[model samples]
Target: MARLELKSVRKSFGSTAVIHGIDLVVEDGSFTVFVGPSGCGKSTLLRMIAGLEEVSSGEVHLDGIRCDHLLPSARGMAMVFQSYALYPHMNIHENLRFGLVCQKTPKAEIEPRIQRAAEILQISHLLDRKPSQLSGGQSQRVAIGRAIVKQPKAFLFDEPLSNLDAELRVKMRGEIVALHQRLKATMVYVTHDQVEAMTMADTIVVLRNGRIEQVGSPAELYARPVNQFVAGFLGSPQMNMLAGLGLQSSEDRFSVSADGGRLRLQLARRAEATTGDLRCTLGIRPEHLALSERGALRVTVTGREFLGSETIVSGTLQSGESIRASLRGAVEVALGESVAFEMDLDHLHVFDQDGAALDEVDNALPVDSRQDEVRQASPHHR
Candidate 1:
């Protein structure tokens, strides 16, 4: 296990910078995931830590030692790429033992290491099979087993399951989780998939154009996002955004009006922030909305999807802005029919015109994270 820290780390290609000055810390034996949209620098940041990319500035420290100047091998790290980078001519046993052989590990110790890794990955029976003969899932396991024989200080994975089918991806997710519990190894994974990050990470780092949007546990981010971007990025169905005007009500309550429909909101802590006719945006998740007789908003259904246990309805709100509702059971509703939906105030989120959350979180987060300074995004970085 190892602790990894990045202090104002940066990277650039000539005059164009891909990764801005960023700082972070990954605790020993923790699984940290880097998630964002394409060209958001998640993969580039991971490659920097793996020593595949040189640092233009700042420092990378591992276990209290400055390691940015060291080679990947000397840094005691193992990387598993998205593609199964296995040697086709080599059988499973050779693939597992290749790293040990490269390090000139004693012949006596190589066999036992290979045996243990093969057993741990449940690939012992496939030792005699070549890469060409194995399935996608099996080939990926061999690649992971190759990394395990090195006994690296940390494991770095770059979208390691993106090529597999949906079913195999789910199965691999469980295997990786079990492997982490059994070994307690430090891990850093890079992916654009939100579902994988939500399901597998102990901590998720949301990035955008080389800057971190937010960092928190899966539950923490889901319940309390600092801004509209973070809220809209993490959820599966995504949060619905609606424009409205807020008026301060007496007794620490507030009211919102959109298209002549009024809804009372209770906000006790931030009464000062809600004074006057404030223009703000209201956000709500699909599951937090339900059909009701006296609902505040009415929608004309445009689409209905039955997702096994849950039914999702997509329609335009009273204001014509689109919104989705995840109601209980399978809902059978005809297209263009009007349906009333009641918003759960407990799950409702309010954002200012600038997309900052109206609710003030009193927790002590990092200084760099609290300040959202960003550079002009280039067209190439999309």
Candidate 2:
């Protein structure tokens, strides 16, 4: 196993600096994912780590040894790219053994390695076929199998599933997890998909503009995101952000007001909120809103989507803000109908104008209990 660390890592092309000084560590045998949107420098950073791109400054260290200046082949790492990139002319068996041939590995050892990789990827029967005959998913598997044959200390995958269809991607996700368990090798995966990051990573690095936003387990980032960007970026359907809302402090808890002190909802005390009026923004996830006759706000249903086990309702709130409510199982609601929705006080998240959370333990029940309640409702990576 290898522990990868980048200290003050910076990359620049000409005078344009793409990667800001970055400091990160990937522990031995852990799966770490770098995730963000396009132009976020995720792929550039990955290439830098792979030694495919020259670093302008700082150092890349693996297992306590500096290797920023080493060639890609000298680094004990294997990479799987978005394209399968197989030698189309070669059969699967020959393609799988090509790397070993280039390295001048013994003929006896090459066949065993090929056999092992094909068996592990369950592509033994297809070994005699060419890449042209394989499906997209199967071709990608062959590509991954090539990396597996290398048996490197660490594996780097750059959007390896982007080419596959949704169902194939899901199947490959499970396969990658199983492979990780079987080998327990260190892995650094890059993707623009939060769902992939949430599902695959032991540690997630959320990056933007070549800088690291937050690094944490899926549960930590999901439960207590450091800022608004992270809170919005990590969730599906996104978090409902009440941008023009005002805050009113009660004796114990706080209430959110719209249109100058109109009670929209009561909120749990923030662990960092004060007694005075604060310029406040509120965030409530779609899954946190419950449909109720006694709901605090009524929304005009604009659309409804029934997704097997759950239903999502999109509507316009009384404040003229868009809101979506996700309820477990099916929901009985119609378009153009008025529906009432409520959020548990404990589930309300208060953000300041700068997009930071507030509520300094305005002490009602022990804040830990409510925090635990938040934890209970939170979806954690298994």
Any idea how many clashes model 2 has?
A: 10
Candidate with maximal lDDT: 1
Computed on alpha carbons, the lDDT of every model, listed in order, comes to 0.83, 0.82
- Give the local distance difference test score of model 1: 0.83
Which digits, one per residue and each the tens of the lDDT, describe model 2 over residues 1-382? 4999999999999999999999999999999999998999999999999999999999999989899999998898899999999999999999999998886778888988999999989999999999999999899989999999888889999999999999999999999988998989999999999999999999999998999999999999887787778889998889988753544666656555642343344555554453556677667799998876546556788998889788888998666888988888877677888767666556566677787767432222222322221211111111
Residues 1-382, candidate 1, lDDT per residue (tens digit)? 4999999999998999989998999999999999999999999999999999999999999888899999988898899999988888999998888889898889999999999999999999999999999999999899889888999888999999999999999999999989988889999999999999999999999999999889999999999998899899989798988886775555455666553344444454363667777788878899998776556567778998888788888988656799998877777877888777777767878788888887742221112321232222111100
Root-mean-square deviation per candidate = 9.4, 5.8
For all predicted structures, in order, the TM-scores are 0.90, 0.90
Q: Between which residue pairs do clashes occur in model 1?
A: none
